[model samples]
Target: MVPAERRTMSPALRRTLVIAILVELAVGGWLLASRVLRVPPALPADMVDDPLLAAEIRALASRADRGGTPEWRTLGEGLLGQGAYAHAESAFARAAALAPQDIDALFGQAFCIDRTGRMAASNPLYRRCLDLPDRTEDGVGRKPFALYAIGRNLLRLDDVQGAEAAFRENASFLPAQFQLAKLLVRDGRLGEAVRIVDDLLRQLPLALELHQLKARILEAAGAPAEAFLARAMEERSAHLVESNFSTDYVRPFTTRLGMPRVLQEVESRLPPVPGDPRRDPAVLEREIQPLEALVAEARVPQRATLAFLRGALAADVDDVAGITAALGIVDAAGDRSASRLELEALVRDRMGDAVTATALRERAAAMAPSPQLHRRLAEESERRGDHAAARHHRARADFHLGKAAYRRNRLEDALREFREAAVHDDRHVATWYRTGEMAYHLGRRTEAVEAFRRVVDLEPDHER
Candidate 1:
């Protein structure tokens, strides 16, 4: 019989094997129970007043009443309360699907999605709720919260113009005056923003946020003394918001002066040139006198900035001597590297010192090769017919400009710039090849072929 099989079937051995298997099975079952049977805690007693979400939750409750898992609702509410926004979103989505018309579930889903940083997804849902004909009259169409959400989202995306329009539309519906004040502050209407915040603080003296907003607005409006007082009040109110307040943890309010207004002021104070004859010399001197006086009285940073501005104005007027004088002032002030370099470049350029200008530009490039500066150098080199220098500068400029142009669908211009850039730097073989591909898309067959051939020569194995 094929080497008589050893009959090793002992009862004790079989019993031990069976017991081990049973223990494993018991452990696995416990693990499964732990994973699938654990229930989430209950929601807070006070329900959120968001009607759309509330209705959706009610529908989910109805589904639970119909013998669906009560665990689903519990999980969703628990996730929402604990700020587990993403988890809450999925749970609420399931709850909403199970009971579509449940306003609570829908609102919960939207709220969770919004809080989870899914503005693109949440916006449409919020809009859909607002568009519904059967929406409740509890200010559904005119709800400040919904409007604020949309506005805040737009602001976060840097869609300032859109945010301004939305905020204006919903200004009347906002529950707190502070919200409107903050929006105004964001819009650069510091005076109005401050007025609104002041009104709110009169009613709610404990509103530290309102006080801080007022302080920021006042500072932006140039009322430094009043701003400091308001900041003091804000610190006092901080203790009420939370005990054991620490200054290090507190967010200091910021003041942002409007760029356009600052530019306008700088422009207005610029000294007039003699050759322009556009305005009276006396009038120009009078206009600039106040600026000079202000410069003397200003803080170090502001004085340095003003000195740079004056240098720029002098260069604009072809006043080489004046430019040099202003640059000296800036240098004496110190701690204005950017302004110093900028003024130096301007003066050098104005004085027809191309070599000096190039040196300064190279230094600036090494420091910070901003696209504007690169383009300036490129254009200047091109004007002087220095093709090699132009090519180098253009390559630098194109590195930045190409992406911006591509984003704006100016493919032809981008292709041209990339091609020119490739000609400037043979080491950028990949960029050269990409230029050919872009040229092909732009229908420049001859240019594309030349670019491709160049790439092929650079790298024999390069695939077209």
Candidate 2:
């Protein structure tokens, strides 16, 4: 008590004085920074003005996981993954400023900026990662990631050899090796591409990407039979994933494993561009063996399904007998099945029976809201000059396409498709809901909230 008796100032006054001194010091530091540094901090100019963006920035900044440079870098990487480009750039820039010697921060900053499509601006930042003395003495750090990204941008800039050199620097990185194989293929180095794909396939036999790349490499190498077979294997894997998860309805994780985009990509990668006769009849016939082999290996119930695919392909190749036999496998007398109707439409379309094809597509559209059936209906309506009907059908097609992308957890693609659907017809509650969901996943808070509000307005009691 005696020791504490002689305070020169009141505790409250002392506390207030201390706070005032801190405020003056902070203001002086700000002024000094403005005068001496002569450069504003690397931050988004509209961050404070954009309420939704500010909320996101604040949420990230206040996260308990945030404590220092490493955590900031990690948070930045996560934001980049979630498509929050501006916020990620800010976080990375701050981390790099705090610890100028941090390779991870430097790389992250470049990578985040690169993701925003500013390839030119990111180049120097990426170079800094490689040139820095902060590079670890032994372990693989962000070097491989940086190199792979550089290779991608270099290719975009038409520097193929430079891209190859960058990719080659990280031989063990799978994406780098994968891209290197593609570059080798583009340059007619088929043998090298084949070896790379073979090694990758050995390591990841079930990877849809590797299988698709292998198919192209084999096709490039004049191994059409091998290409056809590899493509079949990829389809088989895809179907297995679809079969397991299509009924889940909510959990998209397993659906993502199915790789729906792979099938779409296959349409482009495969021989025929639709409405173009680039696919040789002989080549198409050669493809029949792989289809037949898959059918032979499949369960009894799957044979008829494979036969449906066989018929559709046969129609494309002008194989009348093959189409007839495959149809016989279906044996659906007076059938109303959507798959059979769709196959019939393809057959009729190939036979130049436009009237019959349109009729069949309309019938299929009634039973199932598939994009194919709806798109055909849209085309038919447009041809008839029924603009409203055409728009309605087109919206349905986009909605269906969006649903497929959504179920596969391709949020960005799903959001795009849903937005397109809305452009055609914005009345559907489900479309709004899905649009909101995708926006939410991509960290598009404003769009998500707006879409959700639209949903509530469209259907008051719609299940969340």
Candidate 3:
């Protein structure tokens, strides 16, 4: 009896041992795969000296031929970091086609779109990826990046509250945090913006961008001394002072390819004021000397963009000859024709050459139609008491803006846009229809009925 019991117990113990071993092996395999999948390849020192290394790396990736694999996704990330956005987009698209469930591919595609200035078009893709199961290896999941992207696009669409909510969902996202601080400053909530900047500085003491941002906030808050000190700190930051390249360019992996151009564009659009510290003449002169040298030395499109920026600075000071000289350089480049034309129109309009300005405007309108430009034209026409033209342009601007908002599913924003269109031109039947539809969905029955009545008044045979 004892021998029989021992035989049965030995079989049972062996089975239990086998099960435990299998479980351990499974866990170990998962851990190894996770680590291997998450680690990015290190960049070689030669990559710094040889800018073409990115192309070589991409060539190697093309030979991998392992669709849906981690290798393709990694290569996509590397290409994106190197600013080959079109190539990176292709790689990500291939990966996504191979593995429809892969969030990384989807995110990469959306990121590339944003880099290419298609932020609004990337929104639906972001929403789809974020709705997937949480496969993000990072502890924050996809919320930080997705919310940041959504918030940025929403801000562009004029959905302020929606943008604020999206940004507030992920404070760890530095871009969104920076935007939030800017919004706070814009809304006169200086204390809140300052607190946010302080918190960010505590986490990233070496962040020169944050320092620059803080400088802007302080200047807005009437602290010129503090603002200047912040700028000094930004300039002295090791990340900037240690670099021969532009601080933004040196941190290529942390910034988008067109960041410098975007920053320059923003600066160019600032209201021309002689002594505005934000556009200080002394600082502009200091900054442009290096940029001018770089433009002469560099052979990239950045040179043309920089030349345009210099022209913009000259325009700020009403230096017509300086502006003409700078613009001539940009015109010679042949890449900024549209932008050059727009700038010429602006200068002519500001200098009170209405005939030339009108001709430029007609040319510009033929090239591109922007809601912002139309709205500006409307405002200018209103100022000149050209009510008919103002009404026409206002109707065009609001109609376009409303349709854009509607496409983004910003119903309330669309409603407001449509209402503005109606205010500008009550006979705009499409605007009245959209207003009624949006109001109905929002459960404002009375407003919906009123809007529908207007639509019927405009077009009696209009179908819902």
> Candidate 2: misplaced stretches above 4 Å?
1-56, 59-84, 131-141, 238-464
| Candidate 1 residue runs with Cα over 4 Å from true position | 1-287, 329-339, 349-354, 366-387, 394-401, 423-464
lDDT of 2 by residue, 1-464 (tens): 55665656788999999999999999999988856864322334443332333455445556513366776765575455445577768778878987988987787788668867898789778877877655564555666666667887888989898999988887987778888888898888989998998897777666677778789988877898888767755632332212111133123212121122223233344554445464555554464555456335333344565466567668766777777777777764334488787777776776778789878888778887789778878988898788888898899999889878765646688789999999998897878887887787688999999999999998988876
Candidate 3 lDDT trough over 10 residues, lowest sum: 241-250
lDDT tens digits, residue span 141-200, model 3: 554566677887888889998888888886767667777887888888989999998888
TM-score per model over all chains: 0.36, 0.40, 0.42
Q: Candidate 3 at residue 460, lDDT?
A: 90
Q: In model 3, state the lDDT of residue 349.
A: 65
Q: Model 3 segments beyond 4 Å from truth?
A: 1-80, 83-276, 336-338, 362-372, 383-385, 396-413, 445-464
Report lDDT per candidate. 0.62, 0.69, 0.70
lDDT by residue (1-464, candidate 1, tens digit) is 54444566678989999999999999999988865884432333333433323344455544443433244545566455545566666766766676665555666677677777787677666655554344364534323455556666777787767766766766554333455566678769887877666666666665667777777888888899888767655523532222111121111101112222343465565544445543444444454556566445433345565566666556656788878888877777775565477678888777778778877877877687667888888887888888888777778777556645654546777776676677677656766776776676677889889988888888999854
TM-score between candidate 3 and the true structure: 0.42
RMSD values, in order shown:
29.9, 25.3, 21.1
Best candidate, TM-score: 3
> Residue 226 of model 1: what lDDT?
86
* Comparison by TM-score, 1 against 3, better one: 3
